[model samples]
Target: MLYRPNPPISFTGAVLDRADHIRADADKLAELMNWRARLLRLDGLDPVIGDDGALVWGTLADAGEHDELVFLGLDESGRACFAPVSPANKGNPGPANPRLWGAMASLPAGDLATYGGARALVDWHARHRFCARCGYTTKLGKGGWQRKCVNMDCKAEHFPRVDPVTIMSVEWEGNLLLGRQPRFPAKRYSALAGFVEPGESIEEAVAREVHEEAGVRVRDVRYVACQPWPFPSSLMIGCHAYADDPAITIDKTELEDARWFTRDEVVYAMEALKTGAEDGAFIAPPPFAVAHHLLKWWIEQ
Candidate 1:
């Protein structure tokens, strides 16, 4: 079944046709990069929004000879879309600059999704400049969809990778489990989450994270929804589970606090999404996060 939330998750509604087969066709890819092709305008890995709050685009004419162009995909009109690699922003660990977030907030969901994908793709290309296997300089290949080592004897190839993270709500006695990381804004509490480790299933990761972070055993883990979080590329797997014990022994190393919230408190926080309200039991996550939709789905149930 297709997991559809009331409103689609932030970066999952892209309208682009990611033509994967064309990446391997050198002649076809080159043909698509004509004067009609569009280039996404970016500022240090951030989007460059036009006055109308839409993603600003340019033509192939705007590109420099030295630029390394990444094929984003095909637009609705079948015109090719691309983004150039920026040296300064390639390996940047970003939640994005505060000002960029404001500009991004104004973007339409589709544009935001497109930009998120482009940002992640280009970032990966920039950071991975050497062959992991051979430690040789890597050159862009497959229309920037892959990296190939320059060493003749130790030829190697690499592709972009996304880390999987599990974010979940643990319910017990009708209360939802929420926690705050030290980096979160004051009073902000959202679903508990952690990266999925190797040799673990999603269900196991959810249960393990819950017990490790809050000392609460959870079972009956079920997927809720997911969001592509491009803070250097991560897929946030949203889920829900039942907790046998409400008791929380916060792992001070992982969280600043962990607690259960009543249905009334959660409803109050959900309503605050618009006004950016504080002074409640805790600040709820913004709509951009899958946590918000997961919590919203829980409320609907």
Candidate 2:
């Protein structure tokens, strides 16, 4: 049996309608203050979780005074939604879940999408407290979707950014090329990935990344899928590319190792990782990752 996890966060679930025009309306803003509206509380980037392995949401009344709240659109039922960033609880006492792993633990699609979006937005806000153009403090605007510099002389607006990354599984003949970064766990290897440089198309980025990191030329760059990677906001564009040559010249500065793996090796590695086998020659990315799906697609072909 083939193992496939739920679609990556931000790609699944129904997000609220971003009612942009009504955001500035006083009456509509007041309507969000109703007690029935839901609030997602975050401590830094981590969400507050409940005992049932779900995000702990509450009404506006339950929010802390110091919380920085952002309107996160209305749900299908028309209930207003907001996400508040609170100070990190040092002790993380009682039911507070860890960031990444906790979020992946069987969360409902709606909650996962909400958490992913909130984390990205709050992260941007934290990093962009001051404007780059004039070095003035910025204020939130457009329901937290944008920030504007406070300096009257040079009021510059800033918006949240999602960095695009091209993650590709390069195949040569019957084998796939996988590499491991220095930061990766021992014996683990996955697809080659790099940030999409400005002015470069997605296909161009894939070819350049594979060549730059492994000294392998590739062609036929084909799009597979995309995932919202909210570790400081990245959109992972998955692809498959055909390698022109099998030889690999690893860039030690970028990767610890780069090599080709046979089909059987990949299949066994995936199976081992899925079954929680402690000992294995190779370990692939977990099912939640786009790399895993890329590999699965390749294996099924």
Scored by lDDT, the top model is 1
Residue-level lDDT of model 2, residues 11-109, one tens digit each, is: 346467777776677587787778778887665567777777777878888777875567888878888888765433222112223446546656777
In candidate 1 the C-alpha lDDT for residue 276 amounts to: 74
Q: State the lDDT at 77 in candidate 1.
A: 99
- Tens-digit lDDT string for candidate 1 (94-180): 665566657556789999999989988888887898899989898889988898999999888899879899999899999999999
Clash count per candidate = 0, 0
Model 2 is weakest, by summed lDDT over 10 consecutive residues, at 88-97
- Candidate 2 residue-wise lDDT at 271: 92
RMSD of 1: 1.5
What pairs collide in candidate 2? none
| Candidate 1 overall lDDT versus native | 0.88
Model 2, residue 51: what's the lDDT?
79
Residue 205 error, candidate 2, Å: 0.8
